[model samples]
Target chain A: MFLKILYHLFVFLALFGSLMVVVSKKAIYSALFLILTMLTIASLFVLMNAQLAAALQVIVYAGAIMVLFLFVIMLLNLGKQAPLSRRSRPVRWLGLLFGVGIGAQIIAVIYSGFIPPAETTAAASVTIDHVARLILTDYLYPFEMISVLLLVAVIGAVVLARRHLVQGVETVTETAEKAGK
Target chain B: MEYMIPGNLVVAVMIFAIGAIGIMWRRDAITIFMCIELMFNAANLGFITLAQSLGKPEGVAVFLFVITIAAAEAAVGLALFIKIFDDRENIEAEKLDLLKR
Candidate 1:
C-alpha cells in the first residue's frame, strides 16, 4: 500500500516537473525543473526494483547532465529576450492541439486492454551481480561500442568548439604580422 | 484473467508527449534541448518498467547504453548550440535560417 502511494506521488511529481520544464519562461528554471523531473523518475525506477538504473539516473541525468546544462546556460548568458521569441500564438495553439491529440491516442491505447499485466512469477530479482554478468557476457560487444561512441563524442565536441578559436587566433596573428611589416 | 497495462508505462507516454509538445511550442534552443532530455528520461522510464515487468535484465542493460548516448548527444548538442549562438547572437530555432542557403 505504501509503495503504491509512493508510486503515485512520484508519478505526479514527474508530470508536474515536466510541465514546468515546458512552460517555464527562463531557461535556467527549465533546467532546474528538468533535474527535478529526472530525480522523480529515478525514484520511480527504484520503486520498480531497478536500483542500478535509479542510481545511474541520479548520477548521470540529475547530476552530470544538469550541471552541463547549467554551465551552458551561464556561458550563453541568454537575456530575458531569449525565451520563446520565435513561437507565435498560432504555432503554440497548433502545437497544443497536436500534443493533445497524441496524448489522447496513447491514453486510449493504454486503456484498450491490449497489453498484458505483468506476471508476478516472472518478476526476477535483479541484483547488481546479475546485471554485471549480463553486461560482461551477453552485451560485451555493445558495451565496448558505447565506450567508443563516448570517445568519438568527446573528440567531436572539442574539435567543433575549438575550430572557431583556431580561426580567431590565425586572424589575430595575420593582423599582427601586417602591422609589424 | 483480465490483463491491464502497467500504469508506469502510461505515465511515461504522457511525459513523452509533454516533452514533444514542448519541443514544438518553445523556441529557445536550450529549452528545446531540455525538453528533448525530458523525452529521453520518459523513454528510460518505460524501458525500466518493461524490464521489471517482464523479468529481464536486458532492458536495464540497454538503458545504460541509452544514458551513455544521451550524455554524448548532450555534450555535442550543447557545443553546437554554443557555436550557433556565437555566430548568430541568438539561439531561437525559427531565426536559424543559415542552413536554408
Candidate 2:
C-alpha cells in the first residue's frame, strides 16, 4: 500500500514536471524541467520492474541527450529572444482541440476495457539476464542494424561539422590576406 | 497488474504529452530537441512497462534499440545546432527564412 502511494506520488510529480517543461518561458528552465520529467519517468519504470530500462532512461536520456540540449542552448546563447507571444487564437484552439481529442481516445480505451487490467494475469518474473539472452539470440539482427544506424549518424554529424569548420577557417584566412594586401 | 493501469504507462503518456506540447509550441530549436528526447523516453518507459506486464524480455530489447536511436538523434541534432549557431549567431527556428517562401 505504501509503495503504491509512493508510485502515485512520483507519477504526479513527473506529470507536473512535464507540464512545467512545456509552460516555462526560459529555455534553460525548460531544459531543467525536462530532466526532472525524465528522472520521474525513470522512477516509474523502476516501479514497473523494468530495471534495465530505468537505467537506460537515466544514462541515455537524462545523461546524454539532455547534456547535448544544454550545450546547444548555451552555445547558441538563446536567451535574448523576445518572449514568444501566443499563436493566433485559431491555432491555439486547434491545439487544444487536438489534445482533447487524443485524451478522449485514451479515456475511451480505458473505459471500454479495450485494455485488460494490469493485474489480470500473474506477471512472470523477468530478470536482466533473461533480457540479455533474448537480445543476444532472438533480436540479434535488429541489434546489429541499430549499430549500423548509429555509425551512419556519426559519419553524418562529422560531415556536417567539418563543413562548418572548413568554411570558418577559409573566411578567417581570406580576411587576414585581404588585410595584408 | 498491481494497479488498474500500469504506473509506467501513465508516466509514459504524461511525459509523451509534455514533449508533444513542447514540440508543437516551443520556438527554440534546442527546447524542441529536448522535447523530442522526452518523447523518446516516454516511449521507452511504455515499452519496458508492457514487456514486464506481458512477462517477456522484448521490452528491454526494444529499449536497447531506442537507446541507439536516441544517441543518433543527439549526434545529428547537436551537429545541426552547432552549424546553425555558427551561421546565424542565433538558433531561433523562426529566424530561418532562408528556405521559406
Query: Per-residue lDDT for A1-181 in model 2, tens only?
Result: 8877888788888888878777778888888998898888788777776777788888888898788878867766776552443466676566656665665565456457665555444554567899889988999899889989999999998887655444435533345557769
Alpha-carbon RMSD, each predicted model: 4.8, 4.6
Span of ten consecutive residues with least summed lDDT in model 2 chain A = A164-173
**How far off is residue A120 in model 2, in Å?**
6.8
Which candidate has the top score in DockQ? 1
lDDT of 1 by residue, A1-181 (tens): 7777777888899999999999888888888899999999998887777789999999998999899999989898975745664557888888888888887898788678765667774455566787899999999999999999999999998876664555435433345557769
What DockQ number belongs to candidate 1? 0.57
Model 1 chain A lDDT-worst window of ten: A167-176
Which predicted model would earn the best TM-score? Answer: 1
lDDT for model 2: 0.74
In model 2, chain B matches the true chain B with a TM-score of 0.91
In model 1, the Cα lDDT at residue B85 comes to: 74
lDDT of 2 at A174: 47
For model 1, residues B21-99, the per-residue Cα lDDT tens digits are: 9999888888988999998998898888877777788888989999999999999999898877776677888876644
